[model samples]
Target: MTRAPWMAVIGLVACAAPAERSLTADPGAETTPVRPTHPSGIWPVTPPGADSPDTPDPPGSATNCDPLHLVATDIDETLTTDNDEWDLQIDDPSYDPAMRPDANTLLQGYAARGYTIAYVTARWDFEMSDGRLASEHTVDWLHDHGFPLHGGLVFLAPEPDHDGDEVVEYKSGVLLGLQAEGWALDWAYGNAETDIEAFLLAGFPDDSTFLVGDRAGELEVPGIPNEDAYTAHLAHLASVPDVRCE
Candidate 1:
């Protein structure tokens, strides 16, 4: 917690909205530079070199970039299960929102063991009008619901009044601006009660916090509940090891 190497580039412009422009609903690809080991070939089984979402540097610090085991979540009902009527399905243009069975295969098995997901959504920084940026349609709906956004990072909510303590002050201010750059969030996922009070007010670790739909386990904070399927919490996060910080 000895931050200030530009505090993760000013916490990526004060939390959310900056993927180096070009997403006017796909003007031939250009978004995906929020860092997490790059690889934004817009996901289709990338993972070869991958790490160039414009590289403004903010992964870790062994002098700059290396130790980053970050995992975070919260996409309407903790990865969409009836998407809690997202304000009456946000003007339903053929709605279509249903994920949460395995919740993107448990965050693509925590991005294939290297962590770094961070999709902390309260979804609302609207700017649509053919000018794009409702967090670029929530990163094309997490790449059309296949999640694991290349080298993921989607955080949104600068306005549009999310209510309830402003969605716990905009998701604990994007997890305290990714813990002001040191970033070791480790694990997080939610379904509300203001996402366990914004992940214990951005300090995380009530045994790695998890919860899904219907007030999961009625939260008293011991977290880990995954309501009805992350298939046994993705086998209890594959035996939880790989501490990603090399």
Candidate 2:
């Protein structure tokens, strides 16, 4: 994970609204072996959402109110960049720290409010020379960037390509896997439609659960802050202290 500040890759769409700044992810190296930050922690578990135009997130409100679990984000177009690819380890320390996205900062806002944090992506699982599936390195990178995420998980992508539909289908497996092991989610976030997979599987059924991200297509859940970026979104919602991306 001792590489450069890179970009991301995942296919998603966005509205053609004007933006003050344009930030898109550059795909980075293939997935690597993640050295867990919390060896016993279930971080890789896909991690919630909302408020209103009139009302606001009360001080210490979401802690007892919001889901006490992870926030699932699409790394490529949504969180990092708006591309279909990522760049490999680049020691370019000045690659623009601003481009690194501040999820860890945001999670602290939520965690202070009392939720847990985790990151999940479609970065395929890694394989060893002997064909044995090894752990993924995306989490290591998260730690490298100070994302505050306890664990990270990658999808098992098909050879040809994996689309949003497949993501929608398998997300439940990931959630159940985490929940069965004692993880509970109150909110989720992402900047793409593929992010809907976790929501569909979550089936929270009320505004109590959140689905925040850059944009959510037809998700229609409450507590969801559809934004181009939470870091950017934070500027707008300065009225509240965004809990740690807890």
Candidate 3:
């Protein structure tokens, strides 16, 4: 399938807030502009030059940026890449990415500006929040690194109650269920086509639900805010405009 490319500049509203934001807490204030990229300053890295290629624009001709909300990015692509995660979780007792360079700077920027930085994923479920072997294993793995997720909703392999048709339908129903429960969701970011299904369910009406990474022909919706999964995830965040936390 042909992927759509759309670019819509969302309006930015600057606001004041306390620094030293906590990753354990949810979003609290106005959204901030994208920060400068922080550098690990490793010699092996290639410093970006003046002749770098243009960042790819959004698809579907882009959507009008929502003034009230900012984009939500995928953890794998936007925060860290597959390779990096692999290294961290390479010898996982339960298989979780280390998430080095944590993207704390970026997340902090968003938090200071009041924009919600949600770490959306299909990793696990609410039932696993505590110490369930499955949940504990996944949570422990992510925590070992610095994922900076406030809360998470895990998807434990489709349900046995749903029929073939219902399986897809139910995966979506989960989001609606969360919202009905009063989860504070300003935006969403996730990987994969099924990941976007919730965007549609939640109403594909804002820039808050941006896509990151290269899924190629897997999706039809326009994912703005792209990033590299696992290995490149940190590098991509490093490529963000004005990122300076390091």
List where candidate 1 sits over 4 angstroms from the true fold.
1-21, 24-63, 79-82, 85-89, 92-117, 120-135, 139-152, 155-185, 192-206, 212-215, 218-221, 224-246
List ranges where model 2 is wrong by over 4 Å. 1-68, 85-101, 127-137, 151-160, 205-218, 222-228, 235-246
Model 1 clash pairs are 33-53, 38-51, 38-52, 39-51
Each prediction's Cα RMSD?
15.8, 13.7, 16.1
Task: Specify the highest-lDDT model's number.
Answer: 1
Question: What is each predicted model's overall lDDT from 0 to 1?
Answer: 0.59, 0.41, 0.36
Off by over 4 Å in 3: 1-80, 83-120, 124-132, 149-171, 204-206, 216-246
Report the C-alpha displacement of residue 120, candidate 3, in angstroms: 5.0
- The TM-score of predicted model 1 comes to 0.31
TM-scores of the models, in the given order?
0.31, 0.51, 0.43
Query: RMSD, model 3, all Cα superposed?
Result: 16.1
Question: Is 2 or 3 the stronger prediction by TM-score?
Answer: 2
Candidate order by decreasing TM-score: 2, 3, 1
* Candidate 1 C-alpha lDDT tens digits along 1-246: 222111111122244434442232244554443332222211122222434333443443222335566778888867877565454445552355667687888887877676767777776755555455455555666666777664456665656655889878767876776577567777887877887788888888877887675566777654445455576677777676665443
Q: Is candidate 1 or candidate 3 better by TM-score?
A: 3
